[model samples]
Target: MTFSRGAVEEIAAALAASGLILRGGFSFGDDQVAPAGPSGAPAKSVLLVGQAGAAPWPHFQRWLGQQARDIANPLDTWSREVIGAVAQGRGARAVSPSDRPYLPFQQWAMRAEGLKPSPLGILMHPTYGLWHAYRGALLFEDEIPLPDAHVAIHLCDICVEKPCLKSCPVDAYSGQGFAHEACLGHVRGPRGEPCRSGGCLDRNACPFGTDYRYPPEVQAFHMAAFARL
Candidate 1:
């Protein structure tokens, strides 16, 4: 069935109520986003979905165990399964962040929401802060009208203190760009206890959206994943 923006939004809201937020999206003619489709068929548009703060973790944790088999990357696995099911149910195709020839979700997000990056390189959401994440996106053959993207006031621009810079133990993020190796090294070291068991100190230090911070256990899960890779 052909879906209108309102109908798609209803789907988005339903998903959001279950823990995933339809972050935003874009519409393109078939020729524009060609060759990226899972079946190699052109998609008319894509809607981005994500997790904000601790909202999705509880839902995800509960869903994780019911899986019939164990998987290495449970988060990615679950995201694809759930989002794909939803999209398929609605006659759309589901895509993931890990999809080959990766979709530039960050750029898509910026276009979708006119968002700018934080000092730590994470997108500084006006409301969700640095605590949110893009899980996956849905591609549709049916056309949906695009929403107007407006630039929000970048929270980092006005913040003079910039505590995210100083809060990190290893000084991993700065004007020099993310010292990925340095971060991994520190997370593996004894002094990385707080970060290893909790989460990135710099990310947690962002004052704009403290209320939306991921739970320690959730943060620890992601940190552990980063440490392993």
Candidate 2:
């Protein structure tokens, strides 16, 4: 099925109220299979939905305030509720990065947005940098007419100093892959006050996309969640 530009715009407008953005989209190819939808049929296309920086923080905080204090994975819950509504209204299926089967969101993101991984293992955007995330995706059984994918310069390639690899207090990202335990220990310890209250020093050190960096409160929320996990 053909999706008109107006259709895409309408979807964008619906998500904007909740501070979500339509990151990008692509149709499934033979080499890359489409995920199965609720009907057990393969979805023909997918439109990625996400937030840049702290765009969804206010909406999320308001939602959190209204919820039970002990709710688990509140962010994921909010994403599902919001994106699921859009999918229902648009006759599509909603899927998330944290779904049971674990869809290839990272690979799909690379294809859709022409992004590459940074030293921090986050997909580095040319403009948004590391302050963005893929919350969910809208899956349609019909092939949608999406804009042509354009190549973007990998910001990490041009980054000479690679400060993100060196700024962590624990040297968590010491090039041998993330020192997960060491990073976790530091974030939970008394000495981790800076990162716990602010954000990951390594992530914050990246000079790119300074304008889009998340505020301290938002970073604190994410840091707290990471510590819990």
Candidate 3:
């Protein structure tokens, strides 16, 4: 359940060299209490997170339309590599923070895992908005220490505008929860102003993390997924 900091850094370096970009939210504290949000399991001893992305939007765009069925190969590649390295000797599962059977992800991550939800949304960041998604989560037989836990947050309770809710052309999201069907219909078939005018206005409207924007083709592939739903 423990390893030297240098060992951790080595893993990070190896993954980075392999193409997976490291997101800085490492935690090494031993807070017996397991994380309850996301997948709601405190049984894990370590947490590792990495995102999948492509360098040029154009290359990504072609991948989406060409042989790459599930485009975003580069990011997915990073995700698989890092997760594989981390799970070198363990069993792992890839999970999305969407409609789940157990407790809501926000509650569990915040309450059990000691993970704090971003003010924007439980799993979403004001910067990444909804465009980005957690490619997959790696669960270890025991806890793994992280570099830091600066998941600094802002509370949405005081925000007057609540732009995330109102921004959705089809009103797919609300204080209650996300309406996937409503969102997908609009994005795939063009039912509302934002979906009709551009694409997913709710995600695009966010003003944070502009540098890590999702490519257009990736967006299109996502839209296709929505349509099938």
Candidate 4:
């Protein structure tokens, strides 16, 4: 059934009540427009969530699981949730994260749309810096009413020291951009030290997301996701 934006707002309110804060960014999941139907009209709507003081990780997982019971059998990941919501809205084949068409299509879309990669190679919110992460982005088949929000381009623009760049013991963050291999090496290498204790030094150094720092256990849970990769 097609849901009105007000209905969506209500649903979002409910989600927020559960400790998820809907955050606006320069883009959803790195500003990649989650494509919708076969015609590619763009997603009718997108849902973005942020954990409050702590990463309400379980609530998010449960939300998806509950959604599946009412909708498809399994709308597991962000991509799946996006696809299912869009399909429900459009009543046709929806976009799928695992659809194989999406991965490469994203790059092509970025090129076609002139969506430039952030100089940071990571989203630099005015508030949240590397400390924050995008856990998931959901596209809806039906447009969920939401206020227009400006996506944050550079969270560090005014800051002078830019500790995120300086904090890296290994110099993973280049002034111009990020060196992924360098970042992973320091985090994963047996020789890695500081990173083993807390988390990415450069990331932890960011002052934007200090208020939003995940609780220790929540932070640990997400850090493990990175470590596993």
What is the alpha-carbon lDDT of model 4 when measured against the actual structure?
0.50
Collision count of model 1: 0
Error of 4 at 24 (Å): 4.8
Give the per-residue lDDT of model 4 (tens digit) for 15-102: 4554554443222342655566335555555544444455455565567665544443232364344334433533334333345554
Clashing pairs in 4: 5-145, 25-151, 26-151, 85-141, 86-141, 124-155, 125-155, 127-208
Question: How would you encode candidate 3's per-residue C-alpha lDDT over 9-118 as one tens digit per residue?
Answer: 76566555544443443332456554443245544533434444433344333443654555443544535544566546343333334425532334434332234443
TM-score of 1: 0.92
Q: List the residue pairs that clash in candidate 1.
A: none
**Lowest-scoring 10 consecutive residues by lDDT in candidate 1?**
29-38
lDDT of 2 by residue, 156-226 (tens): 99889999988887899976999999999999999999999999999999999989999998899899999
Model 3, position 134, has a per-residue lDDT of 47
Better of 1 and 2 by TM-score: 2
RMSD of each: 2.0, 1.1, 6.0, 7.2
Error of 3 at 184 (Å): 2.8
Best by lDDT: 2
Please, what's the RMSD in Å of model 2?
A: 1.1
| Runs with alpha carbons beyond 4 Å of true place in candidate 2 | none
| Runs with alpha carbons beyond 4 Å of true place in candidate 4 | 1-5, 24-34, 37-42, 58-120, 141-145, 151-154
What TM-score would every model get versus the actual structure?
A: 0.92, 0.97, 0.61, 0.61
lDDT of each: 0.83, 0.91, 0.48, 0.50
Model 1 regions more than 4 Å off: 29-35, 68-70
Model 1 per-residue lDDT tens digits across residues 97-177: 898888888888898888999988888889888988888888776667776788978999999998899998789999999
